[model samples]
Target chain A: MSDQQQYLIIASHLREAIQSGELQPGDKLPSEARLSQQFMSSRGTVRHALEKLRAEGLISSHQGRRSQVLLPALTQDFDSVVSFSQRCQEAGKTPGERIHSREMIDAGPRLAVQLQCSSSASVLALVRVRLMDNTPTMVERIYFPEEIASHLSDYQSSSGSMYQHLVERGVEISHAHSTVTATAADADEAQALGVAPNSPLFVVNQCVYTADGQPVWCSEQHYLPELASFSINNVKERPSPSFFTPGRA
Target chain B: MSDQQQYLIIASHLREAIQSGELQPGDKLPSEARLSQQFMSSRGTVRHALEKLRAEGLISSHQGRRSQVLLPALTQDFDSVVSFSQRCQEAGKTPGERIHSREMIDAGPRLAVQLQCSSSASVLALVRVRLMDNTPTMVERIYFPEEIASHLSDYQSSSGSMYQHLVERGVEISHAHSTVTATAADADEAQALGVAPNSPLFVVNQCVYTADGQPVWCSEQHYLPELASFSINNVKERPSPSFFTPGRA
Candidate 1:
């Protein structure tokens, strides 16, 4: 094969390795000399394959260090309220959930306000550790009104998606307004996720509402920044640059 | 005032404190007993107020631990292709850049393919240390067609926005597609960003395209996850529980 076609083949094979998670994120690939030997190509040809992977966001390399394999594509529909399970499956991975705690509790001040009721109301607090490929990915805490999740206490939430369970019970969760923030994981969370305390985590706070606009659930999802990513699609222009005012162009 | 009104007032105050960064992310709030004593209210009322802030993604609490302030919002527009400087300005802050290195280099095989050009084509490589609020935020490495950024060699890029420069030059940057991943910082990057080596950083590899679909630039932006966030809207349609198809309802 010609040099160009040979490099393309090498690049394609490497890209598949990355997408398949066979070469996990942060796992370094062989050096140029090694890749050249392994692929039976010249040093120049091996470098070309690496460069293409880097350009496509599939790998990252440094001047003196070896290139590291990246995670599967984190890009997803940002405007659609998709579940963690759905996202993982879309990426061809098995998404699992481990119930950390599930119990009915007194509605606290925030849950009460979001549920549009008094603090004395009963609520179901569901806490779970979500996983992808057995790697702890997120710690989610969800609160639903007892009137809504009344049967949650007895539900088997281990094998399937919680939203699916809710939908089956007639909870029409249509959309959510979410706020995302960055924070240093505290000792507890970092320990739980097997990372150092103070490691960064993306915290997503979401308030789900029904089609009729009634708030149903207030949930907090904290993701290990390395395991997942969120995406958004925009057809119209982005919010005008900050310099443009209402009266100005 | 009624009990709910009093709690709401306290919640609002706490929310403002968190938003202003006076109570920073991970800072512990006053104990429930202390808050009630300080505010001259019942413990139930203080608890109620704290709960409201928690529900709004402003704070978090453990069963036995004091509630910690949630991280401040660090959001990126998912739809529009805007520069980091523009985003900072939108948040009402000055964005700054320190050019670390700039040089003209030969485009390699992979880049040549991505740019749809010859491998020996000349390119301008730009690396800048981006800062916000007097702290290092991100390291952006941009590669451009030499002809496009030729004048930038003499340009004092300090505190300047590249997007603004491109616009001034009549370049219409319509959109970009980016792949996001999470990885540990290396020795050089860790030292530059003042974070520990191997600390987690959000790596965004982006290929920016013009209105006519030409690749204008390719960049790799590494952000200190603790210092920034990328936010996107997700939709909810209750996809089926099948592990193979995540988005199909």
Candidate 2:
């Protein structure tokens, strides 16, 4: 077989192992020397195979350790109104939330429109970094109105889900309109997400409303591309309606 | 004002102009010297403001020319099963598709599962680049079974919508499951999409099913981040369901 074909064979074998769950996420693969021995291939060929897997995001390499299988991207439902913590738990991973900061600020004209409040209205701005399996996956900045903000005093001290907290406070989430775009991470986002500057990020700008059609909050969530994916199901009857109404509430 | 504040003021003014439709897409702004004169700011401040706009994907600069406003990202509805051509037309831009290649190949194991056919079944593979106003925006590779492929003789000669063609041939697209992710573009994708190599791309993997619940086509669409965005509306009662069923057909 050609040298390229030989390396592909080795890569396919490793890929199959990953697919079959023989090598679970976070499990380290054997050392390159051991892999070379088992594959009966040269060290260079084995290295080539590993590189192929890395490009596909199947494995990750760290200094002073063998390559490890990466957790497959967490799938987020397009139509779900669940919290990040709930989604993570549903995927069989422990979810964590670290509240970086919380402060009350005057809602600016832009935010005031989204919140359906006056510009001078006080809004609670909460910055948080969400974690899956204790690894930072996304940074979220959420703004809540004064009434809802009053109930969130214990949020910082407690590790409870925000959706649950809102529910307990008599808030009924009706729907959310989300605009999903891709952009390079800014410096603050890079630091919070533990990625290099200018890394690609999937951004979701969401405007959430209450059951009575009152806008409740606006959130901007930035997720690492490698850690999250979104799924949507589209049918013919309801042709995709554009949720992004530019400059409209 | 501080020098930094001066530039920020300039950026906000330009941003307002873009948002208000005063500066339409493809319209060139005044020269840097003129901007400096108009805003009563230094040339450095004008350049800084332009850079900020560029970072936000609002404008593009060509060699030795004033920057021009970019067409805002085209928003695709998550619930719609519309053709790209129709979407572009709705956005008031001419849509074009250039078919690069078409061939028949044996369905591989991975593709066979998606197509719900035998691995030895013949599949028609087509490669095309989608364009907006004659500028390439995305590259799509689609696979179809023989039944649909047989009626696509005019696909190459006529600039028509594939979805329309299939519908005319009695193919009723029931629904499609789409997985969206962000990744760095490969060399081939970069070339086809007219983007820099390694540029971040929004990729959508779609599996289209017919009314009989049979998978009819599979497509991989790689979009330039600057050109497209996806929108989803999640409601409380009929919440968005997760379409990603791992390890399932």
Candidate 3:
């Protein structure tokens, strides 16, 4: 296995042991050298695995003492937008969607700028509520261009998972770009999310693209902070100097 | 220039032309072939540049019509954490900071759990406000381990940017992990940010590490979403069948 996968696997095994109560709080973990011997990994690899556990607040080694259990595990967080679907299945929870409204509307100046279509073009707009185990968690405002909207023979079933329908129609979703910001819930959003009016929420705006580079759909989703968020790891580039031509953004 | 940088430069040139009124709304852009010849770029490269401009609503091509200027361009977005400092300098805005409070406190169970230190250990905690154009934009709550905290001979000037101080102390800051979530401003946060209680804000939690993999400092920064946010681009992984041992997180 690759070093990355090796460390993560060791961390996962230790995490499961702690979660299963095989290793209680204040219990000492095996020595790093012993773990390296058992897993046939380098000493650095074992330390990395232990550090991963420590980063999650699971284990700690301090003041020349051996590593010991500190706290229980947390719900694993997801960074991808597909996490809403992937994490639910991982946790064995049923993921669902409820369509609140769908209508054909004129592509007004604002949305026309988004879909790159004329203002007179007809667009399919929808308001959908995503649920986890029947509890509403997110409210989404979605828009599709006229070319895609006109091909919806069974819009209801397809709306729940447009990816499946699109795949069957020979469309492959390749990538997406997303922006996340904070917002206060409006009355409509609060009602749909079952939160108090003006509650704080995360608003994620994304544009999905097909493999052929066509913009397929755009969505603005509002999520309760307690239920959803994202994380990222960043590396600082030590730019000795950057003198490339064009100096592009 | 590389293909990626080439397209961005062309798009930037167009953006500036539109912003300076050299290109007006409904003005026709030169043909892709013509642009390719002008920039000495491949046709595909020129097309990518125009497509980028179209994505930002600066220009658009309609059915069987030449590409024309559409809506003006939007503000360029940033995906990196250092964007706050870099963007302000680019916009010629003065970025400022104010230290509100600093104190040495016992690492309570809550924070000790985060720092991996004993509850009785001393930790340095500080609160500071970051400003842009003399307007309060964010409030930061930061903590440091005892070892690093004790090395602070001149904590005042250094707190503005811990990076410079750490570098001077033979420490090289490397990478960081961050989480983004939305929250309602508490009373203390509201007063610091000059906003109403319950105002929606973006809370960024970050753990910074040194080059040798030691955790250096942790900070929880609260930002007014209207002023600051982040974006990301993601790709859907097509997982082929896998039977490898040790499936890890």
Candidate whose DockQ is highest: 3
Q: What is the DockQ of each candidate?
A: 0.07, 0.14, 0.17
Stretches of candidate 2 off by over 4 Å are A1-80, A157-160, A238-249, B1-80, B157-160, B241-249
lDDT of 3 by residue, A1-249 (tens): 865468768977898898799997558889887899989998756866775555344565352557776544432321224335445555566667888889999989978877778899899999988777777878889899988776665655622566566666776665555667789999998998899999998877877765344667888888888877666444353110011010111
- lDDT tens digits, residue span B1-249, model 2: 754468768977887787688988557889999999999987756876675555344566453677766533222332234467666666677778888888999998988888878999999999888887888887899999877778776664333378877777788765666677677778888788876676777767888776445677899887887787766545453324332221111
The CAPRI category of model 3 is incorrect
Rank candidates, DockQ, best first: 3, 2, 1
Candidate 2 A-chain TM-score: 0.63
Provide all candidates' interface root-mean-square deviations. Answer: 13.7, 14.8, 12.5
Worst 10 residues of 1 chain B by lDDT: B240-249
Score candidate 3 by lDDT.
Answer: 0.66
* Chain B TM-score list for all models: 0.62, 0.63, 0.61
Residue range B45-95, candidate 3, lDDT tens digits? 676666555433345435345677643343332212433444555566666
Query: In angstroms, how far off is A233's CA in candidate 2?
Result: 2.8
lDDT of 1 at A143: 88
lDDT of 1 at A249: 13
lDDT of 2 by residue, A183-222 (tens): 6778888898887777777767887766444666789888
Q: Could you tell me the lDDT of residue B57 within candidate 3?
A: 35
Q: Model 3, residue A101: what's the lDDT?
A: 88
